[model samples]
Target: MRHHSTQIPESSKLSWMLLPTKKNTDTVQSTTDVLIKAGYIHQSQSGIYTLMPLAQRVVTKITQIITEEMERVGGQRMSMPSLLGPEAWKKTGRLESTGSELFTLTDRKGAQHILAPTHEEEVTSIVKSMVRSYRQYPLRLFQVTRKFRDETRPRAGLLRAREFIMKDMYSFDIDQQSAISTFHAVEQAYRACFDRLGVPYVVAEADSGNIGGELSKEFHFVSAAGEDTVLTCKCGYAANEERARGRGASGADMYEVEGSEQRVVVPAMRRPNLLKIKQAWPDCGELTLEHRKSGEEVASLGQMIALDEVCADGDYLVDAAVDGLAVEGIDNFSNVEVGDWHTAQSGDACCKCSTGTLESQTAIEVGHIFYLGDKYSKALDLLVQHDGKRQPVQMGCYGIGVSRVLQAAAECSSSSRGLRWPVSIAPYLATLVPLENNMEHATSVFATLSNICVNGARVFANNVIVDDRSYLSPGFKLHDAQLLGIPITVVLGQKFKQSGHVEVQLRVPRLEIATCVAGVDVTGDGYEYKAFVHVDQLAEFLVCALEGQF
Candidate 1:
């Protein structure tokens, strides 16, 4: 995409009104702000955005990467209806379970419908009708499409938006063992996908929220504007705050459930983790938990109590702990053990590693994978005959936030002047910036580099941008390159006008590429560097640089 051919921002439209004097500062709330300031995206509403051409290029590249990874794991791409009937979600009990976060509508026929948030329910119903025997086990289906979440307060641009692009894959296996294997296979694919982005990320144990699952993990990009809190220890133990454990949180014994009608009053407000009781007993609708912030003494070890002694008189705690807690088929609150109830914090001692201190950081959740064991399949009655018996199919779902990832990558690489995008997802591989009077010479170089290919991938042409906007000053063009976070930049100015050598600047580090060019002149002042390569040697230099031959 050529800067001159860009017609949306005419005249002072390129004005850096929102450009912060510093990068990643409080002035810049998120990459969304930077993208908007740089004309890469435009805010259409509170949580909705219109991706400009530059943003589209980045998203397209991200989507392509996701597609490759999904396919590598035998995923077949398919599209499901964006507007879905409420019946499937209802059958799975997610209709009311989803609550306000769901976007629902009443058609002219008075039928309720919802915009797709995730495809679990829809895909399960489809597989239920289509596949019957175990012969079709290990099937994988995926799609890259827009999704809606009606966020109460969308923030950080694409990071938490009402409308977004997501790549969701659903897998079906004949049994739990097969499903676990398939989950790991897709996990590696997710790892590959993030690794290719060239951005730093972390995989953490996570709790499956509304998405019912037996196992879950999250892939996150650490960022200031990120919404999720992740705790990591140097020893490689990591988990979302909700699921993280700390040595301080001791596993304590609690009264066992006796009669099905006994009700235990837990301090819902003081301990958020205990509220997951709803999930602990999903099948028993009678097990209701009211969320309320209670006193610190609510359920501390100091408040231990006996189940038979539990009182119905609303005196929440007795004998220093829980007295009456009852749920059908649930023998105890053993699931909320010591460490499980504690949300790991910045200074907590890592319980798993025992040697490392857990450090807390905020991160954007770019991808999530869940192992659904007989949840959706059982709810939708998707069964398969195996060993001469019909059994519920095991399933897994994997998702990568395509748009959020674009924002996250930029946010992760943000710098003082601008943000350095990973080479794989940058809008352009490199930008050729020419001073006002050097368009002709820069165009010649651009044309030449446009045809160069390296490592089986074309590094130029569509992947590169030439700032030929003659109306802008050379200084403005150069600054724009830095603002857009172009991984590599080539400048043809007075140096090129007099001599045949051009300047190359890397966005992230201050380094010299003199090795790529014969008779290369290199100079640097610590934070910035310039490598002058003759016009004749520029192509070879870039090919080697792009190929990582350096």
Candidate 2:
């Protein structure tokens, strides 16, 4: 029952009636259009936007959810400077690795600064100075603030914005095992936050890109407009294509090839590296090889056999690690079986289980968690004493794109009718509209509903809106409410004046309305209803409906 005052006050010089007067564009027709038309956000540039009153309300609710989850996991909230010096990035070598992606500028004194896309370097530096002993082994710090990224192509409104809000957290542990435990704790917290948001998301193994780490996982919201390709197997194996791997054949599938010896060269020898080889040699055919002996080099196969004796007593080159091949006496060596070594395709065999097959889908990356190990700590010399010896601290980082969640939620819940937000995150739980002839009755109804309480919390006052603009028709107001995605709409129309029954439109589907109000005629779609209730009964019904009591 935490109470937060509404941003917009009654006497304030702001009103939803002025939304129609704002500038809008019809060129882009998506949920972003509905947001703009509804006056939630205004685009300042290609990827930058100004959050209007309505949009701010939604963002606030989202921030609150993240904050609650973070606090539950003992994450101490703090704020770091957005403008960072080049010293820390240089020490970590990210200044060169990040290249153009790191926005850089020269200060008046000729010192370089970067608009931090992330706070890894800064957080490590801060913890380095503060933590010196193993007593502070598992330290977790988090911040919910704006971040700047130099996106090559910024599009889809807030989904790929240049300036956005993010919840970034850093964890420090005394050892790798403790760091892994901390990582799982943060992962659970993220799951709770996403569940409260009510968005369909998947956690998949991911490549630790510029943010160097040993293991990485991304939380992706499944949507058609997503940018990342996620591969999932029925056997419960999931990973981003960048880090996906296929199941290699076991000893039972090994066979001998009777032909001239051909050399196969794969640049990298890591799990993800095989996928890269496949991309470079798409035309190369697959080769089934026996498992290699201990300490055997994949590159030594070319030296072991001659051209005539192809059937050698050695492992086959299903995948190999060689730079290039040149036969000693032959003019050309073209009989090699060079297949894809790097990428796992959509139909690749599931590495985890035999019965499952791999499938791919596009998804929006809403959050990422990385087991950083000692990459940053060692680079920055963030040592903590343990057992009378100083060692680099194990670290982990977790991030959630706060602004991207807003766009993703809209994409997930949008429909031909309008945008419908979840009750927990909607800007307003409901909109109260008074028909032109029923203004007096609507005023009394608004007061009664606003004073309603659910679990010691006021249900409406700041959470409900009264569309009392007399100049607009009831139909237009209703349309506007639907467009804005308000969960419920209480209309004091002809039905209320004639039969003392109000029409409550439930924009969200699968909600229990009948259980809240007895004998209420709910529509087949579970979206519209006619409820006959006295003033006191009306308050009770709204409390139950908004609180999801059914």
Candidate 3:
């Protein structure tokens, strides 16, 4: 097999390469600063950015990885229009549900159009026109395109940008069971994609907001700067804090309290409405009630009974959080205490296991997968004939924030030096730098490396560059290389001058080297270098080293 060259030219000659210096700000450091300094992207507006050459290459590489994984899961790539009619959204009732986050506009003819934040309705409509029978079930269609949302405050660079790239896939099936199988398949594909990109992520049970689904999962990259709160238990149970739930101890104990004899009888339930209780006893001062076992003040007198003991005639309803509390019984209650009514919190006992305790962490949501059932299919009248009966198509939606992944990669990989991109998604694999006025030697070395084919293909033609800028000093060139976060840097000046050898440095930090290079030193924190290789063996050495063979 012949390998095609993917070599990029020197930065000095490329007019479009705009590597700007870092801007001064008092806030904490951000990946955007590294990106700006490395010439990857530039801010065009408050929440928009122009992907420069370097950024474009990185994004392209990430997209390629995603495309491969998506294809492996039988996803058929197609294009969807960014602008959609209001009727589709209105039919799904998302036009109002989406609130101000949706960007709406009117055309010259006074027809309302929305810059689609998602394509569920449109995709369902398109599939509806094509498939009318259950035989067309299990259809997986995907597209990579721009999505627009009118965010109230689009901050965090690409993470919360107003316009961003997204890969959305919709799966249509004959029933709920088939949709579930497709859902898991898509989930595994997502895992493969993120794994290939070297992103550290966690899959958490998430709330199905706006997308209206019975089950949803989110792939979140754990970072301190993340916007979502995640709760995890050692029992392997994890969930987004918004939808997280926990089991409570059985409410079986009760005690008598001395208060106004006027027993305010309310409904009985697992989690009683505390607000309604407060309204019923507004004049009642702090009613301090103690826990039945711990003797801690977990509830008040006016609060509903915490124990599961049913009131003979009347009892106050209280949440399970105050269960087993010593409280006076009230008369005349009807609601039964059934359901896990306690809100999950950090350090709470894990409901899934007997020993694990839940812990909380912040994470960024880069992708989401939802089992949408037949919500949209029913709303839009998307039905297919199954066994001579028409039924709504069971559907699922999966989305990856393509641009957010780029930023997330930077956030996860960057250090004090700069953006340390993983080799899989780096703009370029290696940077060829010459120390002194050594363009002649540098060019010769670059040309040889570019022509040396690996596996019957040019090794690094478009993927290698020579820092041929004569005006810039060696120190600046090296600094720029580090800032750009190229994984490998090869120098052909001093070492080659003294001996017929080229110096190669693996720029990945010691901790990260293990992720990119297999048998490298993982004990320290900084860049590592291999002994100089003879000039003639430089290309082969680099190819093998990058492939982690050496």
RMSD (Å) of each candidate, 1 decimal: 7.5, 7.8, 7.5
Candidate 1 lDDT score at position 282? 42
Query: lDDT per residue, candidate 2, 262-373, as tens digits?
Result: 2332222323243343344444344434233221332344432112111111343222222222212222233334343345668767877888888998999999999999
Q: If the candidates were sorted by their lDDT against the true structure, best first, what order would they fall in?
A: 2, 1, 3
Segments in model 2 whose C-alpha atoms lie over 4 Å from true places: 1-18, 22-28, 247-342, 459-461, 509-516, 524-536, 543-550
Between candidates 2 and 3, the one scoring higher on lDDT is 2
The model with the greater TM-score, 1 or 3, is 1
lDDT of each: 0.72, 0.72, 0.71
Score candidate 3 by lDDT.
0.71
TM-score of every model?
Answer: 0.81, 0.81, 0.80
Q: How many angstroms is residue 127 displaced in model 3 relative to the true structure, after the best TM-score fit?
A: 1.2
Residue 418's lDDT in candidate 2: 76
Models ranked on TM-score: 1, 2, 3
Report the C-alpha lDDT of model 1 over 235-349, residue by residue, as the tens digit. 9999998887664422122322333432334232223344344454444333333233232323332332222111212232233332233232112222222223323467777
